[model samples]
Target: MTRLLIGALTAACLVPAGAAAAPAAADLEITIRNVLPGQGELRIALFDTANGFPDEPASTQPTLRQRADGETVRVRFPGLPQGRWAVMVLQDLNGNGRIDSNLLGMPREPYGASNNRLPALSPPRFEEALVTLGPQGAQIQIDLKQP
Candidate 1:
């Protein structure tokens, strides 16, 4: 019995501490600014991977739609798993639920990406707009652009 007790105690001591603790979820807050005065909806997308980033359809990823109240809009995403993420915003002036493009296939309305990144020739890549979220969470700001 004494030998059995010693062996059990030894095994217990070998186990690492805090192994059962799970990581906490993170909070992410995004603020979109410079939105043109209009009566429409603001479409926001949060992407965790580059597979289907800013241009992905609504069915494929997480998205939020909010009314365009003024020049600025704020959104909060809480309890998100800790990791890297990117953001995209579209100001749907016509409330068409989609971005309108001109003959050249260029966006006709204002849009924005995380980090305020605007590409001159092509769409912004995930790497250019990545944001890291930790236990402390993160807060970001994006400014709308028109072309």
Candidate 2:
């Protein structure tokens, strides 16, 4: 009887607080503002790794393609795991699926990154743009930067 009680206590101690309840799905809602009022598509990409950050959309974990009609566009990524994530938005003004850059490698269209982080020389790093998402999820607003 003493051994059984001790084993039970050990098992309870091993279980973390709130372990009985499963964690909620992490959802992320991103609002892209200051978009040029015109006909275009907003390409939003979510990255969980530093492998492909703000510039590489194809390498992102999940990509969201939405229409850019008004001054702002909203998108949501649901059922995401709780972790650090960064977002990148590109306003394809020419309806092109990709961001158009000039000869000098400057973006010709409006673009934005999570946490509104912008780099002076190169694209924003994942660390600079990352947001911690919890079980309750999070909402982030990014302002488009026109060049």
Candidate 3:
């Protein structure tokens, strides 16, 4: 028993410092409101960085995507590490799997960002819509802007 105890302790100490277990992942719940009467599904995206943030309404790539339709939509992102995250929502009014935009590059369909922030003449940046997820996770609400 004494030898077994010492061996166990030695093995524990031999573990590299960098090999420590990762932090527990948390869940993120997003509630989107102000969904206008439309004919297509909603495309919601979750982004962890500024790159491709509020990506072109037609962009096919996003960290995460969910299709929903309603005056209020709720989606869950489970097992996400506690940190900053940004969300962008597009009301795909044409069911084309993307948001339509006018010639001036303004979205023709309703859209929104995390924190309910929208910048005029341009898309909202990641930092502009950042939300912090604590160890216990977080919940946020966004309101869409109509064209």
Candidate 4:
């Protein structure tokens, strides 16, 4: 019994402190404002890189599709690695799973990006909408724009 106890203690001491502890995950809370209630559904995408960015939802690590039931909607993404992230949200009024645009290449649906940035005569870039998330997590608000 004493030998077993000593062996267990030795094994525990061999492991470094915090080595057995799991890495802290980041939680991102996004608040989308000015959503068109009862329009259609809100397509939200979270991107970790500039590959797809504000345009491609399939390139995102995780995407969310929810109904636009209110003027303001909150979505929380948990268990994400601590790093930079960008969020793109659009109210799909047509339920066609894509943003509707006009003949001039201007969006017809309500859309918004992280940091509430909407460039004139251009689309929002991933870098401009990036939000840093540490172990402490982050919260951002995006206001929808009607073009």
Kindly provide the TM-score of model 4 when superposed on the true structure, using C-alpha atoms. Answer: 0.84
Scored by lDDT, model 2 comes in at: 0.86
CA deviation > 4 Å runs, candidate 3: 56-68
**Backbone Cα, N, C clashes tallied per candidate:** 0, 0, 0, 0
- In order, candidate lDDTs are 0.86, 0.86, 0.80, 0.90
Where is the poorest 10-residue window by lDDT in model 4?
Answer: 52-61
Model 2, span 1-147: residue lDDT tens? 999999999999999998988766788999889988776889898888887676775552889888887897788999988888889899988886778888888888899999997986678888989998998999999999988
Q: Which lDDT tens digits does candidate 4 get at residues 90-139?
A: 99999998888989889999999999889978889899999999989999
- Candidate 3 residue lDDT tens string, 41-94: 777887777767776533433345555556887888888887888888888777
The superposed Cα distance between candidate 4 and the true structure at residue 53, in angstroms, equals 1.0
**Positional deviation of 51 in candidate 4, in angstroms?**
0.5
* Ordered list by lDDT, greatest first: 4, 2, 1, 3
Error of 4 at 47 (Å): 0.4
* Total clashes for model 2: 0
Winner by TM-score between candidate 3 and candidate 2: 3
- Model 1 quality (TM-score): 0.82
